[model samples]
Target: MTRTNASLIGFSAVALWSLLALFTVASAPVPPLQLSALTFAIGGVLGLVWLWVRGDLKALRAVPLKAYVFGTLGLFGYHFLYFTALRLAPPAEAGLICYMWPLLIVVFSGLLPGETLRKGHILGAMLAFLGAGLIVAGGLSGVSGAITGYAIAFVAALTWAGYSLGSRRMKAVPTAAVAVYCLATAILSGVAHLATEITVWPGSSLGWLAILGLGLGPVGLAFYTWDIGVKGGDIQLLGTASYAAPLLSTLVLVVAGLASASLSLALAAALITGGAVLAARAGRQA
Candidate 1:
């Protein structure tokens, strides 16, 4: 795809992902592990169908086992913890905290060969961290369990950051890799569900809609489009643009009555977006 189209796809992925917290929260009665397993299972099946349609199903075996291992761990680890945070805390707050991944990506990208860390990146990260701090502090005042949620959300962010960074180094086809990752995540989550939580499928139409939407949109198509965008488009611009997700996510949660938008949310958005813009500028100059 052309860079413009790729960029649009990338932005679309971010927009879709912004709804993930809302959907995951809506699917609450299902429990985190089971919900993850079901959603990813659906996504994995869709991905396989996509591969078969493209005549790329044969390519899965050619991918190194190491890629599958890391990809599975990364994708699974993030979503599992992310689901936990959404359950334990307000969706808006948890969503913002989890978005630390983009900032982490900007910083970690410098660790690659011949990549230089710039002042703007450092500055931006600090600002973003401060914004995250404000969010956490604000969240803590509202709920007793917010601390644990924030901590898990941060870990989720770190997992995703590592995933994105590691993804850039792999030569495997992105969609195929994501398919394997989703399948592996589903298996592990299923095992975890059996060991811990009761398996309860969504019974309500609203709950089922949320699960299907998450599986098809954010979990399935978004990953493929994101891989295409990051691999083919302006990485800096996409990275910067993704800062909008938290703001948009918070707005969605508020409008849906899942959470209230507060002053902390606005300030956090500004700081994080500012930092992301700065980091993007540094990348462009580099």
Candidate 2:
């Protein structure tokens, strides 16, 4: 694929992945942990099949052992933490805060050779984080779970930055292979659920379909594409561009009545939009 096409595909995956929170919020009876465990269980199989069809099977074979291990660290650490955060806080709060991955990557990329901070990085990251902080500090403060949920979600963002950095080294592997290996880590989490408690969900056709979408869109395809996007561009730009997903999510929630089309959401839209633009410009300059 051309680089521009690859970047678009990658961004689309992030947009699809953003819908996860909205679906979880709508899936009233489903426990977050149980849903997440099941989603990943199913998503991994789907990932393998997808790679096979795409002629990416060689990717699975070429990946390094260390890449596989580090991939697992990122995959499991991120999904598990993010879902656990949902159990504690409201989706909007966790989401907005977790969107700080760009800012975190600005810090993480400093550790990478040939990547360093610039004026745009400092200004854009500060604008993004301050905006995200305002979001977490908004009208939702009455919910005690919000604090814990946002904290867990923030950890998820940090871990994902780790994953992105680790992934940058796996040049021998296809992005597809790394995604499947990362996804397979969720089996441990799924097994923990099965060994401890029954995880069957009461569902009609539509409910099951939603779960399937979660597996396909967010877990399998979306993650695979994100790895592609991160590889295509600078890690910080990819992270910042990802903030756009939540802007899409905010619109969805407004339509669903879970959120108001209020000033806070608009402010978030501006900050995130501006940050992504700045990051992209910085990438071009570099």
Candidate 3:
């Protein structure tokens, strides 16, 4: 496929991710690790079905164990931290903080071999960080748990940014490999949940549907499309487009009555989105 097509495929992940906070919130009371296990297992099954349908099941054998290790760590680490953050803090605040991955991706991409760190990238990062700081500062006044969640969300952002940039280095890896990653993540999450978390199944059908939605959309196909995008498409452009995720995610929460609309969140969203735009412009100029 052309770079344009690949990038568009990647963009679809962002659209899917817009519903992440909503689904996560809707799948409530199920502990983070347990939720991760269930959703990722569903996601893994979806990937397996996809590979079987495409006659690419054999591709898994050619993949390096190290690649599996890397993918598992990336997928598991990001989602585990993200789910925990949302569980501990307000979904909107935690989600916005986690969305820093897009800005981080743009900034971190500068460290790649052919990319340069322009002034605008730095400026944009600073602006976006200020927005994050605003959230952190606000969290401090709320409760200790909120502050902890925000911190975890920040780290989750870093984890995903590093993972996305690293994916570019593994361009030779097939997209089908993400299936293995999902299954591995599910296994890891399952072990962790069994060890630490009490099993709390979704209490209602709506909760089950939310978990299914996450598995099918954000956690499932999003990873595959993202792999294709980062490896074959314009990474910087995708990073810029990713800013939409936070805005859309926050809006979804608000519209769903899971979160309240606040002036602070509105301002932070603007800052974060604007900074990403500035960073993208700088990348293009370079």
Q: Which pairs clash in model 3?
A: none
Please give the lDDT score for candidate 2.
0.70
Clashes of each: 0, 0, 0
Task: Give the alpha carbon lDDT tens digit for every residue of 1-286 in model 1.
Answer: 6877876887888888789779977876888888788889888999999989999998888888888899899888898888788888787678778878877776777776556778887787777666655655565655455898889999999998887767766635455878988889999999988998887887799999999988997877788777777666655556556666656766788899977879989898898788777876886787
lDDT of residue 214 for candidate 1 = 87
**Superposed Cα deviation of residue 106, candidate 2 (Å):** 2.5
Q: By lDDT, is 2 or 3 better? A: 3
For model 1, what is the error of residue 115's alpha carbon versus the real structure, in angstroms, after optimal superposition?
3.4
TM-score of each: 0.82, 0.85, 0.85
In model 2, which range of ten residues has the least summed lDDT?
A: 136-145
lDDT of 2 at 232: 62
Every model: Cα RMSD to truth: 3.4, 2.9, 3.1
Query: Over the stretch 113-173, how does candidate 2's per-residue lDDT look in tens digits?
Result: 6776677866677776666655555675455546678788889989887777766655445
Candidate whose lDDT is highest? 3
Q: What would the per-residue lDDT of candidate 3 be over residues 181-213, giving only the tens digit for each residue?
A: 999999999999999889998899999999999
Model 1 misplaced stretches (Cα beyond 4 Å): 1-8, 83-99, 129-155, 233-240, 261-263
> What lDDT is obtained when candidate 3 is compared to the true structure?
0.83
